[model samples]
Target chain A: MTDISRDDVQHLAQLSSLALSDQEVDNLRIDIGNILGYINQLSELDTTGVEPTYQVTDLENVWREDKIDDYGLGRDDLLALAPESKDGQIKVPKVL
Target chain B: MTKISDYISKNARQNVLEAIKRANDKNEYHALLSFTEARALERADAVDRGEITGRLAGVPFVVKDNFFAFGAPTTAASRMLEHFQAPLQATAVEKLEAEGAICIGKANLDAFAHGGSTENSAFGPTLNAFDKTKVAGGSSGGSAVVTALDIVPFALGSDTGGSIRQPASFNGVVGVKPTYGTVSRYGVVAMASSTDTIGCFATDAADAELIMDIMAGKDNKDMTTLPDFFKPTNVKPGLKIGLIKETTTDDVDPEVKQATLDYVARLKAAGHQVDEVTMPISKYALAIYYIVVPAEVSSNLARYDGIRYGHRAEGVATLAELYGKSRDEGFVAENKRRIMIGSYVLSSGFFDAYYLQAQKVRTLLINEFNKLFEDYDVLLGPTTPTPAFGLGENTADPIKMYLADIMTVPASLAGLPAISVPVGKSSNGLPIGVQLVGQRRSDADLLALAKSMEKA
Candidate 1:
């Protein structure tokens, strides 16, 4: 059995910034537990001294000039894509 | 003149026009989301006028809607992006266009590429090319079906896990998932970043290789792209091939198993040595894939909050309501399921137990693949457990849908180059495909081996 619990699911939802419904939470309680139970099978493997591979590309530290390259799009071009905009700034719902 | 090379070189415009006519004729399939008719015709005329020239000069192709293309909206078969017109083309599309390939249409896919079958597509599931009642094994389902139906000679697809290969197998086309970073992911919609790969579908291995050669390269915009290392090898000395024993178990459909064994027989006849090899960690691949992929999906998909872009809820008074309602309305059930699962696994307290454990298992799986590669030049297996199940067959159970990818997920986890090539067919007449997996940088070699098998 996995150690994942309801509170843990709630904490994860918070971390992921998702406000799941009560039904969703209940469903995930069982789904996450089953998923965790499957993933827990990995604990049997011996990964001693094995290095983790984060990225697949062999090249590293590819630096580029920090100069600002013109994307060639003007304010109108940018604002034209916005569903709501005012005076060149994208309009958003008030935060506070 | 009907050959791919001649068709690409001499009759690009005529070829695209003919393909468009055929696609229009078969209106029942709905394989294409939107056709870039005017743009494609104009580009074809340019190729004919000797204005644009390259290796694939004038060859027309379709891109999965997930890739941002100039002519049509990259909807990703989701309602959220249904009206979202891309400001620019994906780097992959741009690269292919640079080589003189014309983008003709955008193909259908599962919303956010979250499902194994295209049934989860917001627009509607793409019917199988061979049988209308069956699903076009998905998120790259439409891409595969279009190629199989000869709507286009080749199409571009993004494979997060088994999206490309499974569909290709289901449709009897060649599907290639190159080593991660072999092709840049700069403009494609992000889906499990670590596993997401841009690939292609073609009717044959040679055409697939040609397209791969054109698309494989380093891009300054995507830091993860490797320098162009995909050179097709001509050497045909016997190769050390491993037929993954786990994938050929009794659980696999009898026809799929037979097709795989038949292909192995052909490899042996071609003077390549075939041996059964075991990677014990492969058994845990699906579990690892679900945990790690959803964790990434949850993060990657968080950007669609209905604020900055794509769909907004109407009559929303509060910010939180807008986000929740818009997303709940826009995203399909599968997308929500994955996102919630992702949220559950990556939660703080359970991170060590779920996410971290999965990562460790991923490491083990990769190590096992590396060990196998030390002994074998390429790994062989069936691409899917079965081919093209009827639509709605696995819809009731999500795990059943996920299980279809069990044989293909190990390669995705390891970020290895893998391909699905048509070997034979089932007695019931469905196409069966066999998968070939190689070490990270051995994409070209793997394709070359596949091509050699074709000759044999």
Candidate 2:
């Protein structure tokens, strides 16, 4: 099994956009290690000529009309449900 | 005595009002999170007045809270969306309503559909129908309990690995996980997209089929949905049935194994040939499932940042702190565990070693299932290895909980249709269920075969 470390966990948190706490990071280090160890058993399988099954639905390139269809809900109606909104736009905390 | 149609035809408002009252009087099982009494009555009145008419006209049903329905907050038994009212209805809910099925309430589930037992629900655990102390097997625990209690004739549930089938088996009810794309998944909270399916729990296969008939179809919203091919069929005469040898292991609970064997005997007596078959790759199903599922969950749940919706933490000035604290607060321990595991496997250097490898393993599992289907009309096994355990039995250990899904995950990973039909009860009086798995587009045939077994 590939060894997972604190830095590895921190880097994953960044990739996943999760801001984990120090304690959480430490906890994840152990938990992730256990999980990886379990899944690593797959490496023993002889998948020599096996093709990966990605999407289950065999349907392909299901085309639809290129026309824009209105969902009928108005902007103000949708904006009304937003937890934080300003000037008819959804508001988020400022990011650098 | 009220047949399903009779209850459905009676004034929608009064029917739901009485059903809610009956559910409240029991108090033996805490199956519902909240009752949409006012909204249900309003919709029921519309159906009675001819303002609404369809297959489910005025029929009352409950949805596992993971589904986004108006009138009630869609809390997937997580604090994350506890107070978060959905801005819109799930595509599945909207379709059911279009047929006049009034959603009376939202049922409980494991937080983010994580655990095998509903003990992980943020609100509280749902009790099993037969024995109040035992768990309502989850993560669709409340949906199964509500149906078993006869509060509603049916309830909708989302099954990822074994959420619907395991619970239905535990509760002595019919649980169906239609072919993966049979029902739309536009608004149901994503748990593991590759295997996630919306299905239902009902007292009998007929009622389950009625609900499936209404909900099965393609939608512009869910592109993955297959063109509707779900027409109920009669069981073919002299069918070939395969009893999976691996699922009927000595390690499985004796009662569960006996129930399955007895079911096979009955099928044979009815003239369908029952023979033992082995799928060696079946042993590796859970390993592949845990890897691939968490990977997808990590991606799907990333949308729940503290910004747009869901819970936001306080005293966090920095944007990063806000996200960290909010997710840490909103999610339960299992959700965090899964998200972290997902992150670890999908990390830059480990992606091919873990995530990609798991997908390749999944292909082998599917190939084994496909090869078996070519020789057998359908595969039969126990829905769960054992009957429902006590509420806190496997809570502390995550791998133990994952093992409960061993038999059900292969069908899920293959995207085939499967069902759990009540066979008998254990000596302790807990219910036991048998699973019937069929080819990708053979959902109706599987249900028919299950119905024939019911007659036997």
Q: Indicate which candidate wins on DockQ.
A: 2
**Local accuracy of candidate 1 as per-residue lDDT tens digits, A6-96:** 7866766655545577877677677666656666777776666665555555667988889875545566765666667887787877644
- Model 1 scores what on Cα lDDT? 0.85
By lDDT, the best candidate is: 2
lDDT of 2 at B400: 80
Angstrom error at residue B303, model 2: 0.7
So what's the TM-score on candidate 2? 0.96
DockQ (Cα-based) for each candidate: 0.43, 0.57
lDDT of 1 by residue, B1-456 (tens): 123564655677788888889888876877889988888888888888989888889888899999988878889899888988887778888888888899889999999998888999999999988889988998899899889988778999999899999999999999999998899997899999889999999988888988888888988788888878898777458999999999999999998999899999989988999999998779889988888899899989899887767877777777776777777678887787788778777777768766777787788888789899889999999999998899999986677898999988989888899999999888877889999999998998888988888888
TM-score of chain B of 1: 0.98
Q: Number of backbone collisions per candidate, in order?
A: 0, 0
The alpha-carbon deviation from the true structure for residue B260 of candidate 2, after best TM-score superposition, in angstroms, is 0.5
Q: Give the fraction of true interface contacts kept by model 1.
A: 0.36
